[model samples]
Target chain A: MKKILNNPSDFVDESLRGIVLAHSDMLRSVGDPRVIVRSDAPVRGKVAIATGGGYGHLPVFLGYVGQGLADGACVGNVFSSPSADAMLTVTKSIDGGAGVLYLYGNYFGDKMNFDLAAEMARDEGIQVETVRVTDDVASAPAEQMSKRRGVAGVFFVYKIAGACAESGASLEEVKRLAEEVVINVRTMGIGFSPCTIPASGKPTFEIADNEVEIGIGIHGEPGISRQETAPAKELVSQLLAHLTADLDLVPGDEVSILVNGTGSTPLEELYVAYKEAHSWLSQKGIKIFKPFVGEYATSLEMAGFSISVLKLDETMKALLQAPVNTPFIKQL
Target chain B: MKKILNNPSDFVDESLRGIVLAHSDMLRSVGDPRVIVRSDAPVRGKVAIATGGGYGHLPVFLGYVGQGLADGACVGNVFSSPSADAMLTVTKSIDGGAGVLYLYGNYFGDKMNFDLAAEMARDEGIQVETVRVTDDVASAPAEQMSKRRGVAGVFFVYKIAGACAESGASLEEVKRLAEEVVINVRTMGIGFSPCTIPASGKPTFEIADNEVEIGIGIHGEPGISRQETAPAKELVSQLLAHLTADLDLVPGDEVSILVNGTGSTPLEELYVAYKEAHSWLSQKGIKIFKPFVGEYATSLEMAGFSISVLKLDETMKALLQAPVNTPFIKQL
Candidate 1:
């Protein structure tokens, strides 16, 4: 296998061991080894944010469990959703006095698992709310907006909601803020290569040497279209077009941009992509409030990048600029 | 080309433009566009630290320019050293009233360019010092330690030295601390895949699909041997053996470890590597002070990971715990 590891089955557990060993100061595992929470989780008066997802896409689900971010995360095997049992364990561990909000991608499996867990938590007399992020513009049409699958734009949702929760917001208020972010953020990604699942030892998808998939999913699901590989400038322009159209963005609008790299793409390449996106937005008279260029979500060793834009309001702008501290990312 | 870029020849300049666009608050281009300094340079009475090298390695040369890190960095073409003129430009822009230290990797071209820059800056009447980090144990025999090249271990050199400089330490004290870190740190890496330079559009090296290169340099240079890829446990064991022996680390000694991905490798894999390293060290009775697992240094999108251990004394441990804020890395 091209990937590095011990036994394929031990992939997730070994990586968790590494995380526990490296960031013991900020994270801890609970009833289930898969359920990880902040060391100081369950802050007395603050609403808690719990996120869960499959493995492989790091910093997405596990990396977000820290200060100023998600309070807890339950991870499953590579590209597989965690069990409802694990989700319930995390809910019980991170519920502060205020309440707990389940924030995650709009995937069928995750939705099912988290929903089941939330019901169980409610039975336990713990208040719980749910807000699924549907930010990937290509996942669905505008009419079926809720059908959209979340992608890199979940970063903005996490940041805005984390900030609100950290400020001692009520569960209702935090859920509202998170939903608002989900409605405003749109993402479009292009895939040049696919990643292998350690357990399966098989590539998620395939592409010709001269082809690229536009609007590709993180799991390598078929995108909107496949075309000949093109320069970053053209691809970014098309991605922005889809994103701006999806958000109904217009001139004089201010927004924040995140040009994220799928795994295996060099950081320099991501900057190259950002340079093009910045120029495109500038030429259109769109004011960029804050520009983030890095890898927030990845598909193992897949290659390519995504451009996400959040049409920001005054409230969103303040939340976006606030400090964020996590083992995988920090803005201070 | 398997890269997200515009004109390959514009690789460096475009990336620099993107960097300036994204991190304007933390960094700025000096006289030469390639020479970048902190937004607030020359911190009155504090010693200034200037580091520089080629492009492609994000966060290494330029990513370290901010609070609790280097004050300025002059970047060059991909994997190529910055010109003497560019280095001098950075030195002039970031020279605080106290002095400036020229800290960088021990590469032939870089050594020559920075040495010449230091001379020119001295002639201009600004006090200057130099410290070359030679921490890669695989680059040379123990007896020829000074000939070894600097690799990911440079992160420790920057951290401890930057903390010292940030504390208003004198230029002499800062240089001493930097040299001390360079002496105590040792790194070893294994390369699984080669990277392609954008300008050339050619892979740096070639290896059999099933083969791995042990002791590979950051630039894809040949290592001690090429053999069939094995489990993470075996590779990490061999790497730690070289590092602990070269650093003369013994039982009961405290150390900080950085399991660095050489681009392309997934963060999960790096953590898996860290888990093995932690177990190996703990079983040997060695105590771990801090652990960083990520892409601190890279070679474009090369696939590999390096283990860097910095033997820690009380002073070094405290320094390592200090806060660090930069465009790419934050330790707060």
Candidate 2:
């Protein structure tokens, strides 16, 4: 496979260094711990927000670190969770007088490592709270909401919780808000083709030319089913059906919708999906307050789309509309 | 030729509709105008900011509309400028009580349409000012800065000027700051493979398997030259050499850098380019602040990257650091 690099193994480190160099005024790297934090971090009396996940998903872990999002982010190898040691290091760096909150996805490796890191931080006298985002309804049975996998809906939790943390909310309040967001959110995805893993220099999965996968996870995990190609409107129907069934979304329910394009799905197709989705939601009498389309989060080069719905209330709406500045998400 | 689209003609319109539907709380469409404006527009006496460009560069034109960035955006067809009528409608809808400012890249079609719209706005008793972002050093001779094409550097102009507008700067002040940013910024790009336009179902340009095109423009415009594949460091050196020489950048100068990936470049490769770029800039004693590496602005599925540098001053630095809440850019 053709790539622009000196060595594949050096990809993540070099990229992190470049991010630091680019945003030196706003971010810094801890040498021993391999954590990326805001240059003016450890805001005294403010609850610290920390998130870590695999590399590859730019602006998610790294780009989301700034004034109103994450205070620090521990990055792991591509699609792999950071080690407990790494998370602990980041936790220590951003821990001020106020406690630190660990907010991340519900991926198994991340759960394992972050759990260990939280314990380590507790031993070090730093109060820590954990909020796992399990917004992907496709990943688990409707009866077990906690078993759902996390997808891009984690961004909403980060935004709301991060805004609360920046507003000097206590760790308890921030954690409560984050958990509330997780419970009210649901996502479902479809994949058209597989992406290439840089290290392997091969496609992550085999997808035939005339087929698409429904209910695929972001990390290239096996999808729920493979089906023949269909029109954009039909695809939207299938995705929305899965998400609405899982959430049991009723008429007149207010929601914040996000139609995310997995890397290779052009804005053209994404918009087509969005058109149908908006109509469907409207037909159901659902009021979508804040709808985010385009690629807020993505799996590299995967041609597909995902739909996420966050049930919104007045408090959540205000928080969602709060002004924030991060490398990736900014809402004024 | 693989795509998830049902019809080609409906692509741009459908996408715009989706954006409006998704972000209805934040944005609304002007009746049949091909413009998307913030919901709480005509903000009393605030100066309105408007920008326009072709579609396909998701989050560039549409994503930058919100509270503190752009008041409205006029979208064109894929890689094509919006009609003059569209621009005029956008200008009218976003013209706050104070006035309206026109900001856009220096593409021929966009310039023509915006210029016409500015005249129309003036005739309608609206005070209008214009700033054309010309930062692609590859598009013109070093002695003719005004002749350079506008590429990703337009984003910097959007940022600094947007902050100024948010702070209640006069139209003249906003235009002045935007012009200064344009004058100080420079960008150079390279494409390894051509992007396939969805409607055409063909590559925008031809590149041999082992070939790369240097000095590529954002719209698949022909590059300065095509050359054999080179290492990341060498490729970066060649692009930077051209940009810095054109700008006459001196040592000890500080600049905000962006290593932007065209749609299809893997993060791994982007980091490789960023590594060499950071080292080169540092070796020149240039202080890099807020280095951004990602698909901030893109060119469909083109396998390429662009480097944008904005020479910074205290004002520019503050503006860069200012909080922005747009779909694509969120700098706190």
Candidate 3:
């Protein structure tokens, strides 16, 4: 597999090293270089929000750190969770007197490490809370929503929580709002191609050129089934069927829509999908309040996309529209 | 070739349809659906800036149409220029009485069409001036710089022109400053893979899996040559060598850097390249201001990137730092 890299093993750190260098005005490394924090971290009395996961997903954990977003992020090796020690270091670096809130996707490795880090932080007398986002409808049955994997929908949680924390909300309020965001969000993806893990130098999975895996996870996990590639309209319709069913959205319900590219998918294609989504929702009489289309969360060079819908109340809608500035997602 | 589209011929129009629906808050179409303009266009007494070329490069022409960027964009088919009639309609929609400055990449087809559009707009009593960006260093020799093709460096032109227009600079001043930006900019790109033209259902060019094309154009034009794939560091070094020589950047000079990803290149990979560029420039004692590393301009799904350096004087630096808001590129 062809890629732009130095040492495959050093890919994550080198990328982070470059991130800190390229965005020194907004981000910096603290304690450990793997732990990136806002340049102006630990703002007095402001609740600190943090997220962490495996690397390779640009603009996810790290790119989302800035004013009105996460104050800190713990970066891990490609497709591997950060060590608890690394997470603890990041938590300590950004913990203001108020408390720290950890917002991360629901994954076994991440859960184990983040849990241990939370315990260590508690022992050190820093108040901490956690919200594990489980929004991927394809990963579990509707009745077992908590067992679902988190995908691009976690972006909504980050935006809502970051905005709530920036408003000087207490750690509990921010956590509660973030949890609510996770509960109301639903995401489902389809993959046209698999991505290569740097160390492995091979695609995580295989797909025929004219076939696609519907209901695919971000990590290139086996999807619902492999089928002949369909047009953008059909793909969007299929994904929407699962997402809308999971959310049980009623007519007149307002929501924020995110059509996120999985690494290699072009914005042009994402917009094509967005067009169908807009018409689909409108036909159902579902009111779309805000729409975002691009690569927000990704599996490195995966050729596909995920559609995420965050059902919005007045508070959620306001927070979604709130001004937040980050390297990847910025609103003013 | 697999793509997320319906009819191959409908790719551009369907994609534009999606863009208007997804970004309804910021952009809309007027007269011809292919002509996309800001929601608040024709602001009286303010110089309007419009740019367009082919449609495959999503964020290039359309993405830059917003606050502090181009006021309107005339979209065309994939890898092809918009018709002169479409450009004239877009020019008319955003004219605002002050004038309309058409800024776009230098390509034979685009030049012919945009030139014809400028004539049409002038006939209709609209003050129209055109600046075709010639910034891709590989496209022509230094002595024949006027014949160079425009690539990612047009982004610098848009920012400068948009900022100048937002400051209420007259059409002539905006054109002068925009031309100055073109003069100070240089860009070079290498491609790891060829992009497909939708209607053809085949890649526009071919390179062995283990080979790479250096000095490639956005539309898959033949590059300097194809050779064995090189690591990110070496590739950046090779590109920087050519760009620095062309710009004659001296020590202590200030420059804004853009490590732009061609569509499918991952941001993580881009950062890896940016890391090398940062160190390389710092070694030369160049003061980098406003380093941007992402997909600002792209070929539909090309897997590569171009590095752009804009030697910044005080005015250029200030304008580059000015606030701009759009669906793709937003800075505050």
Best candidate, DockQ? 1
lDDT of 3 by residue, A1-332 (tens): 67888999888888999999988888889868899999998788999998999998878889889888899999788878999998898889899899999999999999999999999999999999999999999888989988998899999998889989999999999999998999899999999888889898888898898999988988987778789998888888999888888899989999999999998888998888899899999999998898889989999999999999999999998888778877776463
lDDT of each: 0.91, 0.81, 0.90
lDDT of 2 at A129: 94
How do the residues B189-281 of candidate 1 rate in per-residue lDDT, one tens digit apiece?
999999999888889999999999999999998999999999999999999999998888889999999999999899999999999999999
- Each candidate's DockQ: 0.76, 0.49, 0.74
Candidate 2: Cα lDDT at B197: 70
In candidate 2 the C-alpha lDDT for residue A112 amounts to 97
lDDT of 2 by residue, A40-129 (tens): 888899999999888877657877788878899998887889999998988888988799999998888999999999999999999999
Candidate 3's residue-wise lDDT over B255-329, tens digit each?
Answer: 998999998899999999999999899999998998888998899899999999999999998999889989888
TM-score of chain A of 2: 0.96
Candidate 3, CAPRI quality class derived from DockQ: medium
- What is candidate 1's TM-score for chain A? 0.99
DockQ, model 2, C-alpha based: 0.49
Q: lDDT: which candidate is best?
A: 1
Residues B304-323 of candidate 2 have per-residue lDDT tens digits of 88999888999999988777
> Predicted chain A of model 3: TM-score relative to the true chain A?
0.98
